[model samples]
Target: MGESSETSSAPETETFLHENQRSFDVSNDAVTHDNKKSGKPAGDSDDDLTPDDILLQLGGCGLFQILLALIIQSMKTVICWGIGGNSFFAYVPKWRCTDVDDVMNISSTVSPLTTMAINVTDTTNTTAYWNQQCQLPNGTHCSNFEFESSMHTLVSEFDLVCSQSWVTATITSVQMVGMMVGSFVVGHLADMFGRKKPFVLSMAIICLSTIICYFSVHWIMFATARFFFGIGASFFMSIYCILQGEHMLSKWRSTTISFPSWALELNLFSLVVFLLHDWEHVTLIMAFLAAIYLLTWFFIPESFRWLVARNKIKEARLVVNQMAKWNKRPVVNFERMVRSVEKSLSGDEDAKYSVIVLFRKRPLLRLTVPLMLSWLTLGVIGYGVGFGVKEFSGNFYLNLFLFALASIPFKLISIYLQVRIGRKFTSIIAYIVCLVGGLVVTLVQYIDTPYRGGLTTGFALMATAGVGAAWGPMQTMTVELYPTVARNTAFGFLSVLARLGAVIGPQFVYLEVLVPGLLYIMIALLSFISIMCIISLPETNHRMLVDRLVDDLDRERKQEKDHMDSH
Candidate 1:
């Protein structure tokens, strides 16, 4: 049939699920997608060959690809998250004022907050030092800070201590601006050029920028470098989800989405590496790791779903066939699968996609808006807990390690609940725990009681782990919720919001110093909003992805509801 006729042959109501398969429940060791039970025929026909099934036919869930993907994700987390948190290095240790002349000084020892004033007298050759006359605001203040033991830090290296201390906040906020910019640029770039290239570029950017940050002589230079680092990290947030072999077998999708982050937080390995080296050395080491990953880029395959969606049949088949060989299976029947894919893709080639269209299209809007909120909530709650490292009662490194370690068991539990209860419930229950945990952390900080310190610490850890665990289902649900035509485009849009959350959420911890209990309250509030958003989304766990929209899903749901009403 001709192109026009082929396009006309498919029904408007029947959308082709091009990527991020959502079918196939896992049971014991067996994972099955029962199409017949869902009212489709038993055979794997061309119409039946979803992106998920094509992956299965061509060996999608092999050990090698999974391990490699996990490694990439892990390094990404360390570079983006680990490095963006430069406050640890910017730390200004104990210091005392030392530049005051002994004859005019008001006490020899002075805190940073203490201002220096010279007593005026005719014999002393008195001169007023206030009102910028002595290059001082109001009264003459300590001109130089003498830090304890000469420990190197950005704060001390360029004098961000005391009056100039706002520089640290300025750098962090600027970095967040970089992250927001990176998301918009990289999101469009990924959807246009395909997934792999932009992500690799982001990794490379992070590698260079982080090292530059380490060598920065001025606080401004450090902030500028950290800004670019933030951009790179933010870009990676969207792209890594794109790279999780979005076409993997249904059962493997959840595993790959959370693997890197899950493993990083669940172990002491990352903390061990961090403690082993100084901040500058750590920056260089992370750079080396990024560079190493860049080399491996040559080995990694581009998203085959992208290839197929763009109608690059020759390339898509080549990749799928290689994947089949890797699994020790016979090559896919290219002729059959290609015909199937081409038919499905014929009309979609001209479909227009833009970030703004999300607001115009209800199908996109319902899921898009709430999913964005959920990501924002995750950013706030996750960082709110993650960065409150001081709250835990143990060695800083051990507490950090334990915070990450705590995430594993919850994530594992989320994985089980995801397969058993569904993404919506799994996420809802997780959020509830997150909110409750934050409440406990907030309340326990006050009112004297036995084991108060330990109890508060445990709840603080739980809140962090709760946010961490919630991420797994949310990530998978998002990818599978949208269509292939606009999947990455949608991701790019959400990427902007994600970075915004990362910037806004973690900063709330600063409020704790001012308001005492306000930090945990904010964390719980965002988590509650996220849970509401999660409730708004339709579950994609057992429903298969069809083309770019939920048209088929809507139709099926209506029919099922109608069928139930007839009884």
Candidate 2:
């Protein structure tokens, strides 16, 4: 069956590749013509305006996009398959022919069927049948009976045992709990020490916890591992966003941050596919890969921006010198840059504010409210849809792969829209689309008809676009909106809320599955709330980093006045 499905899918796969190739060809042609007109040598970095430089920009975007997708796919697999034995039953019903009898019959004729039926129950059932039937001289007998009763029981058992909507809700809640605690702890630690230290520590804990999970002897141990895993994950994700923004040039910072998320998504998809067959092996492999990230500490330098912000002028200059060398640019004078940076850091600046000061100041509350709403809504809806991808009726691997592939176009279009239409307008549109899509999904649950496929496809596409738009800009906006000293602290606070939403969103989905359409209604309402919150935000495009709460409040006032004047 697997082979047949793969064969049937070949045409669709080929068509997709052909379309991608055509797009690549057009891009290459444009780059070539631009280079010829400028009379610049290919791959030359001397002139920033050269076509080769443009290609490098595109390359950077692509590299990060691929890596982020890979990471996301890997994580999703671990989350889905790392649960107890009963979780397997939830997925079995989705198989085309799930009856133990039917599987046994199929196994009699096919030796390669072992790959698909890796479970011990499957093997035992098949062996029992073969022994009952006397060995034929020529070949094994193949059963043609459909055995409808067995199929019914298989489906019923799956629905009863593995469909714990309540458990799903509880798991999400626990994840949020971990994220909240981890964000506060890790965020403050990162700020007080440095970005690199927090990142390395988080990666280490993640690796260790994943390893421990493989040997977990009980559900309690597994759940504890999951909680710690969430903490470690939050640390890496938050700190990585900060590092990307601080390291990249302002013009390309958004794209660079956006690209890593795609890799993360892709990683989730890939891990799901592998774990569907061999969960234990895959868990070990994930742990090993995480440990390997430790090597990055050696090569990935500390953020120079953070160093300068903290008055580590010497270290900052040394890191920048390395960057300049790699780029083949002339070395910047360390002593002069240090003096300039010190003057900026120390000159008549407001005393560095603690996290409490942010809440105490009434004016800062305006920024905090919208920021919290955006993060919370984005986390619940964005992550909920991603985690729920396995619920689609089909081959798990194929469904997962398609989901990842769908993101590529969603991301490309969002990048274009973010640039041409501006972030605020594009995000508002995405939120509206998500609201409509959630409504449609709820409506489809009642309609028993052939139109279900169209509804599912629409929901998937809209959700993908909504998530792609929200995830990237939210990270960028969060970092840019706060002062340097309190940036991580503010982000940590928001992360707590966001993780809370994530916990709620999945449980909501499970509830909807139980009560029919409750989750959809909830998501739609949140989407509306998010759209309103987003519209109130000041557009940050082409704006310099504001160093104080006062500056941000004044900017908001001016933006409001400008809006009124235009009206």
Clashes (N, CA, C under 3 Å) per candidate: 5, 27
How well is each residue in 142-221 modelled by candidate 1, as lDDT tens digits?
66655544345566667666678657656766777787788778766776677888777877888888788778877788
Candidate 1 regions exceeding 4 Å error are: 1-10, 15-48, 80-87, 90-92, 100-140, 148-152, 260-277, 350-352, 390-394, 445-456, 549-553, 556-567
Q: What lDDT is reached at residue 292 by model 2?
A: 76
TM-score of 2: 0.70
lDDT value for model 2: 0.57
TM-score of each: 0.82, 0.70
For candidate 1, the TM-score is 0.82
lDDT of 2 at 493: 81
Best by TM-score: 1
